[model samples]
Target: MKIGNVNINGKVALAPMAGVADRAFRELCVRFGAAYVVSEMVSSKGISYASEKTISLLTLSECEKPCAIQIFGNDPPVMAQAARFAVSQNPDIIDINMGCPAPKVNKSGGGAVLMREPKLCGEIVRAIKDAVDIPVTVKIRKGWDDNNINAVLIAKICEDNGADAITIHGRTREQMYRGTADLNIIKEVKNSISIPVIGNGDIKSPEDAKNMICKTGCDMVMVGRAALGNPFIFNEINEYLSYKKKLSAPTIEEKVDIMKQHVNSICKNKGERFGITQARRHIIMYVKGLSNAAKLRDEACKLESLEDFSKFCDNILNSI
Candidate 1:
């Protein structure tokens, strides 16, 4: 799938999930066969101010190319400046986040709040598109609520104002990831826009990915929570789509090995203390649904160092 001049190698992409799709995870997803990945959303104001943490979120490893850096803010000028800053990192695309539903973000005039104000959303996208040379895209939700589902209108606004592509998450701000994502809404957005539409939300398996694309006529599918513990879902979906054959599931031993590798990469990039601390959640996701998984997660969360974490993973693999 091509977003503007950039060719996203496959039809499956990783969603930019804050606190989840960090650098290590994104790189791992790419290695596992995700055609492209987006960085966790960065704050435009924070990036403009050169906040240390915000700058770190834009850090992309060489292996994770064709990556898009997503930024969120309401102010047009600051958002455009943030686009320039993201371009400096040499990302393949700059995505504007108008989909996030977190109260902290929306209350500040960013995220899904933009959905409530279409005029402001257009201005922001136009300004950011005008500021950057790279492909510009927008990630949006269905609308603000049941009474105001306006994804088609917002998508048209984005496409008409110079967005190279649009991603629809198929839920409203009020839903907040609760109910199943509305595929019908995604299809509506696809029908209403001329740019490529990437469908997102509630896709957990290869069959689900196929259904989303076949039903909606979307150009790409973005996986979020489903890929947390299972980056291999990308490879699985690709295999299924291409050959109509299901691949063997990863063995417990294989899962542990990948988990350890992910931990090692995180430690190398962020150091043991912070990396191990941050890895606890991923460790849980990695081991979820296996034998004694809950007990293992309890113990893993208490781990204080990489050595402890490594030993924990080894024990789980050996026991299984």
Candidate 2:
């Protein structure tokens, strides 16, 4: 599938999840066979102020070359400036986050708050598009709320203003992550637009990914929270889509190996001290279905050394 000139070889993609889609997690998904991956939402306002922590989120490695850097904000000129800075990082695409439901983001007049202002959405898209040579895309929810669902209208305005593609999360801003995703809205957006439409929301398994594409007629499907601990979902969905064969889930041993690799990468990127804190949380994700998963989560708080993590992985493998 192609977004403008950028070609993503497969149909399965990793969604740009805030506080979740970090460099380590993104690289894991890419190596495991996610055709596309996006960075966490960057703050346009933060970029304007040159915040180091915020700017660090835009880092893209050589291994993740075809990745996109996503940005969120309210003002047009500030968004344009952010796009310029993001372009310097040499990402394959630039995505505008008009879909985030965080109270902080929305209350500040960014994210899903933009869904209520279709004209501002156009200006923002146009501003970014005009400022960068790379393809520009937008991720959006179905609408602001149930009663004022207007994905089609906002999508049209975005398209008119030069958005190369649109991802339609099938719930309103009001629903957040609750309730079922409405495929009909995604279908309507796909049918209504000429660019590629990526369908998101509630896709937990390979079968769910297939059903989403078949049902919505979307070009690709983006997985968010479903892939938190399970980067293997990308490979599973890709293999199934390509060969009509379902891949087996990871064994306890296999999961441990991946976990160790992920932790090491985090440590190498951040310092050892911060890395332990960062990777400790993911241990619970890896041991999620095991009998002692809850205990593992509590133990995570005290995890201080690589030896501690190694022992934790061994315990899960041995016990489960």
TM-score of each: 0.99, 0.98
Expressed as tens digits, the lDDT of each residue in 1-320 for candidate 1 is 79999998898999999987999999999999999999999999999899889999999988998999999999999999999999999999999999999999999899998998988889998998899999999999999999999999999998888999999999999999999999999999999888899999999999999999999999999999999989999999999989988999998888888888998888888889999988888998998988798898899889889889878977886686
Q: Clashing residue pairs, candidate 1?
A: none
Instruction: Give model 2's TM-score versus the native structure.
Output: 0.98
Model 1 stretches with alpha carbons more than 4 Å out? none
CA-lDDT, candidates in order: 0.93, 0.91
Task: Mark the 10 consecutive residues where model 2 has the least summed lDDT.
Answer: 278-287
* Cα lDDT, model 1, residue 56: 94
lDDT of 2 by residue, 144-194 (tens): 898989999999999999999999999999999899999999999999999
Clashing pairs in 2: none
Off by over 4 Å in 2: none
RMSD of each: 0.7, 1.0
